[model samples]
Target: MKIDATLHYALIFRDMTTEIEASKLVNRLAYEDSLTGIANRTYFIQELENALLEKRSIGVLLLDLNGFKQINDQFGHISGDEVLKTVAMLLTKSFPTPHFAARLGGDEFVVLLDGITRQSQLDESIGFIKTKEKNFSVLLGEQSVPVEFSVGGAYRENGDTIDELLMRADEQMYKEKYKDRPHERNSFN
Candidate 1:
């Protein structure tokens, strides 16, 4: 009788441990982008909401990879995936704690700057990202492909909603994307 009781308790503990691990995995999956291992859109939205509620100075930087489709078409999806993973690694490394980076699906990414105290800090951060963006390259087999992207950023202002902030950042990104060709700018609006 004593042996049976001990065995039953051990099994119960094992089951509980398994349940805890499974729950952790589910939570991670919900907040994380599977391919890039970075925060996903859901996580980004939650963080942004918290920042808004706390009344912290916030800056959002949106990035869109240039010629992403062409890379996918020419080198196959495996190489494209490698490029994305490389970029994700770079973003996370470049912008560590307090600053958040997420993949907003496809080749689009976003970074949230929290508790920013000055315009200079924001400008410096943007300059660093731009410099990194210009220098980084991904290795695909024997070929090296440069990572090129258009980035736009906006600082939160009084009476600004999340949608408005995102829209403004997106507009700036579009402007950067079409800067060379003035005629194509009208279609973005």
Candidate 2:
């Protein structure tokens, strides 16, 4: 059977469109966080590795949300999820293009700042994040739950590998996280 030329082209276009949409959905599912809509850990790691391969000056800002478990306990997971989404929105807004944010599971989130040639730029980014921490709070059922967090950042030094960079940043983050906890400090000390 012969088909009309116009109809044949229209069918081809529709098929192409469907394929494109399916590809997009697959990519999103692979590289995006289901809850917060930010880059998933896999995407973040790949991007970081690419930046390192390109020898770009980059910094990693690691953040851990304080009292997140309490929020999950007191307000429940739904409210906790809302808080995570809000934080992701703020991170995306604060660190636009050339910088990437990812949720490294739970209350841990990270930002990869690329093309950072100066310390001031890193300082500026961290300062903005700290400011956000000061003003950040979520309202749940007439109660304001402050979204407090501890952030630590590490700039890539010469000959630094991904693990080394991540470890340094993680160590700094833990230091910041536990600095306020005297009771727990003795165990580590």
Q: Which residue pairs clash in candidate 1?
A: none
Off by over 4 Å in 1: 1-15, 117-119, 185-189
- C-alpha displacement of 48 in model 2, angstroms? 0.1
Q: What digit string (tens of lDDT, one per residue) describes model 1 on residues 1-189?
A: 268566433343335888899999998999999999999999998988878777789989899999899889989999999999998999999999889899999999999988665667767777889999887888878888888998888778777788987998898888888899878767754
How many Å off is the CA of 47 in candidate 2?
Answer: 0.2
Note each model's CA RMSD in angstroms.
4.3, 4.2
Cα deviation at 13, candidate 2, in Å, is: 6.4
lDDT of 1 at 96: 92
lDDT to native, each model: 0.87, 0.88
Q: What is the TM-score of each candidate against the true structure?
A: 0.87, 0.87
Global Cα lDDT for candidate 1: 0.87
Candidate no. 1 TM-score: 0.87
Task: Encode model 2's per-residue lDDT on 1-189: one tens digit a residue.
Answer: 348644443333334888899999999999999999999999999998988888899999999998898899999999999999999998999899889899999999999998776667777777889998897898987998899888888878888899999998888888888887857755844
**Residue 75, candidate 1: how far off, in angstroms?**
0.7
